[model samples]
Target chain A: MTIEEESGYRGKAEEFLQVFKKGAEFTQDLLRENERLRYRVLELENSLNSATAGSGPDSQSQALIQRISELEQEKKAILDRIQQIEDENQDFANRYVEIEAENNNLANLYIASYQLHSTLDFKEVLQIIMEIVINLIGAEEFALMLLDEKSGDLQAVACEGLDRDEVPPVKLGSGLIGQTLQSGESYFTDDLESYQRDILNPMVCVPLKIKDHVIGVLSIYKLLLQKDQFAQVDYELFTLLAGHAATAIFGARLYSDSERRLSTIQGFLDLLTK
Target chain B: MADYNILIVEDSPTMRQLISFALKRIRGVRIVEASDGVDGLKKISAEKFDMIFTDINMPVMDGLKLISLVRDEPNHKGVPIVVITTEGAQEDRQRALALGANDYITKPIQPNKILDVAKQLLKLA
Candidate 1:
């Protein structure tokens, strides 16, 4: 009875060992296959990374970045150019305004000269001269004096802001007015701000000349309250008046005398015909 | 291209011409000259003027009187008046303003100044 039972137990133990060996072998094969598959997956991932970095996405992105940088530079340069053009335009606009002001001053001179010679009547000529003095010269007190050929003295023919008696006869080469007439050059005060109303001593004296020959003198005793100093155009006006006013006055006097003689001759003719 | 009629009342012909030359810078402005306040009044009565520039020391009726008379007329109630006065005559300027002058400009005026006053008063561009 003991021998048979021991033999059965030994056969069963051998069958169990065979099953355990088969299970261990299958586990080892699975581990080996897993390791090989892991390596394959790593290789595929690296190839994909290299392919993308070599020529596809990375290069495209780099080109796009370079293009953006270039565009930014171009935009900055364009903006700079635009700013320069704007500055130039502003300069031109300012110059245009300056020119416009200069043009107006020239027009004033032209108008003054044109008006001075527009009349032939003696009263009208005198009135024009007075207006030229007050408006153009900005003189509040002034006198226009003509030289007396026989007496060798200057007598005021037209006086403003003063009575005729206030202006006495000035001997040639005696006072400021006489010196202005003698030299045939303009005389201006040293300091216009300190000028006051003086009938004897004038602030400015412009000799009326015809080709370097002084015929009369324009004496300005006081300027207007608004006029502190002479402007650049005022000197031009003085020069113009010196020549034009003298010629205009002389021409007007001659025309007036001739007109009166013509009237007298016409009257005599009428009387003879009658 | 005359749209506005402006009257300039001045005693001196040269002053009138100068004022006219200055006023001509304004676009669409027609200028009318008058010798004195009396003549200005006559012209104002005869025609419809948009504005008036007058001297303070004009002969044959002062500018203040002319302004008052012009303001008395209902048709001229809206008309603007600018007085031209000497720089020293501040009292005259004030009197003119009190008598219905809209503004005042001193003598020895610049053409640009005259244009500015006229453009502002006339509402011109």
Candidate 2:
């Protein structure tokens, strides 16, 4: 494709992105309207709490009764609309699942990338990565380790299933995690039989990379009890983590460093004054 | 105003809290919570509740079974039962209604929906 055609394609993509963002906003509005109608109906119903057939024939009570019925009908219509929108959302989620199962790896990759880097907070970003692995990848017994550049070891930074205290820092170029760090590539082995003997052999190891350089490794120790085996989406998520996770980690780390520097400066000012 | 005793049967603490929170806004409601269907059934047998709000998916027994058992009980024949279900499980909701649930609500449970439905079904009906 020519550069001109590439720019045109990029323009179309941006238009589509804006359209979807607008659609999300519209969905939010519908949700709010649905909530308002719901409250309206509830208020109308609560107003009739004192109504009984013995005292119901009065003009004011008759008006309340008519208004209650009208509100009920209106509520029904609003609920129907809400249900339709919810059905569409459910359909989209179902299709997403199907694509994740069949051949929607690219979409999965995009979503994983979007979610991982969507936050600037380091802890939240790590939490999102962990959720993606557990919810999307269907894995358990995982440890996310960052490479200690000066010490040449992998330190356990975030973990689940495996106790953080029990996990010793692994030497660089020692095992599967080390191998992924050195190679700057993802390595996944479903060889359950072989992994039984090698305690350090993670069933899956994806190196977090900044460009070609490996920064950290997410080691999946095993599949969860409910999940029998890994699927195509898991590998795509691994690839996404390999690329986008590094950027998010670096961004968060940079923010934390700046915050720490500011705190240190404030401390120095206070100490000098004292 | 007559007092209404409502039993909430759900395993997830967050969901139970949400349901309780929504129900508490209405006047004349006394809410009791059971973590699972088994616990709900035991409560149903031991005490008298004006209404039952149950979630479908639980560890020991589900809402359908709870609904069936509640319907089967001679004492609780006319009690109002509401089925709380996930979005994808329309079939289960239908089954619960068939098993004699008075109404249904989908999850990400809306506060107003619960309030309106509870008022419509449980109060002055």
Query: What TM-score do all the candidates reach, one by one?
Result: 0.82, 0.45
Model 1, range A1-274, lDDT digits (tens) per residue? Answer: 5988999888888998899999899999999999999999999999999887787977889899999999999999999999999999999999999887776677667777888889988778878888877876688889999888899899999988888788989987878898998899899989988777666578889999899888899999887889888888788889888999999888998898899999999999999999
A170-200, model 2: which lDDT tens digit per residue?
8778788788888887776756545652336
lDDT of 1 by residue, B18-78 (tens): 7888898777889999999899999998999999999978788888899899999887888
Q: After superposition, which runs of candidate 1 have C-alpha atoms over 4 Å from their true positions? A: A1-83, A196-200, A267-274
Candidate 1, A220: how far from true, in Å?
A: 0.9
* Candidate 2 C-alpha error for residue A69, in Å: 70
Backbone clash count, each prediction separately: 0, 0
Residue B29 in model 2: lDDT: 79
Q: In model 1, what is the error at residue B50, expressed in angstroms?
A: 1.3
